[model samples]
Target: MTRTVLAIDIGGTKIAAGLVDEAGTVLAEAVVPTPTGDAEQTWQAVADCARQVLGDTSVEAIGACCAGPVDIGAGTVSPINITCWREFPLRARLRELATGATVELAGDGVCMALGEHWLGAGQGSEFMLGMVVSTGVGGGLVLGGRPYPGRTGNAGHIGHVIVEDDGWPCTCGGRGCVETVASGPNMVRWARTQGWQAPDHADAAHLAAAANHGDKIALATFQRGGRAVGMAIAATAVVCDLELAVIGGGVSKAGDLLFDPVREALADHARLSYVDQLRIAPAALAKNAGMIGAAAMALRADI
Candidate 1:
């Protein structure tokens, strides 16, 4: 029988499980929403999904990724969005269903980079960055053709990169972070504060629609958001000599609504010779990047 691994992605909005082969193809998969409740309730929801996908398949190992500020050394995760789990023992708990297979954990940003490096938009790029722009902005690095988790496993966390000197305070306790302007919720919040007329429970999608119809405030909101994202990308590209950046997530679906400003900002800020070579592209794997990336991490014997 061919070797296979169990892959799981735990996000604030949803949880996904699948059986993946060594080549990054998903064999079996399942998905469930992240329920509203405490830690154990979320765990049970994930467990049920994993079992549904596992069924009668046997795997040699398991790979899991989550929204993070994760501690791989301690097998724990403390995602900003999932406040219920603060340093929760994730790898250890996953072991309960491991059936003796080894379990590995990683932050979602790192997984996105790994997956993109292996089979998505990052193919053939030796030095690159993978980013997810959603409720929050996330990023990871691929250096020398391998995933580089950095000293604390959050090396390429590009979202937290400070873009404004005295701008909005970030949830990460920083000031003027790229996330402050570009994240989905942040964009909506900013627009509302700027006199946008949002309906009840409006989200980024709703804001995009308003912009599509030529709402001046809505358009300005995305321009500001894109400017922040672009400036950050330009800084990262120069610092790391990155050749490409693969972007994915809910907010990324805004297409050129978000990217045009990003490109303009890049052209304005990245004037260095090496930085001029950087290319920005959309992610090809979509929501499946995290799962494939988790599997890629597990397949590595050298860690």
Candidate 2:
């Protein structure tokens, strides 16, 4: 018998669903705009997508990935940037939608790490950090070969780490967080303030392209963003003793323009030999990482 799971990925911009097999193949998939304002609407969006995908295949379980900071213990999710899903009961809702199937929920960051560990950048590493550098910065950790979801299943929230006490305000009601500094939208905002003349995140990418062609201000934006990210990771390395840092998402599209500065900052800030030894690399799972990781979560339940 073919074992399959219904996988859901809910983000600020999109909600993606798929029927995935044990081999991490997406048998059927669909994506829709995430409904804003109404929690019920957002939940219905996900349920509808799942129903559509399930129509194409027989799935045995449901694995969901939502934006942080989710309470995995409670099977709940707070409002992400794009929606009013505050404290919504996601697992139970999905369970209701799927009827007889088992349901599991995790932060999108954790799903990325699980995907990488199963078949992407973290394939051979025992200690891993799966990071997403997109509209928002988020991540999940695998420590000593286990998922380590913390007491509330919010352990690997790398984005919210206070890298600067005097940094910009974060959506999580914090200041100077890694997300404030390193996220694509944040980077673009910072660049615009520096007189780079960009209006949004896409403009930051345009500036990066300009920097690739020799624009100093564009280069400075990436450098500053990289430094903040590197500083945060340097701190994380000490606590998690991570062996590999796998970065993914749209912002990572900046490539060496982003990693080079991050590497330099990490090398400069990571004073400890142990922390210095940690390797940072790009995420290989790409767009499929979330669904694949959710499947991995079902298959590998030990940690």
Question: Best by lDDT, which number?
Answer: 1
User: C-alpha displacement of 170 in model 1, angstroms?
Assistant: 1.8
Point out where model 2 deviates above 4 Å: 199-201, 301-303
Lowest lDDT sum, 10 consecutive residues, model 1, at: 294-303
C-alpha displacement of 164 in model 2, angstroms?
A: 1.9
For model 2, what is the C-alpha lDDT against the true structure? 0.83
lDDT per residue for candidate 2 within 72-148, as digits (tens), equals: 88899884575588788898888886668788889888888888888898988989888888889988998887676
Model 2 pairs whose backbones collide: none
TM-scores for every predicted model:
0.96, 0.95
lDDT of 1 at 227: 88
Enumerate residue pairs that collide in model 1.
none
lDDT of each: 0.91, 0.83
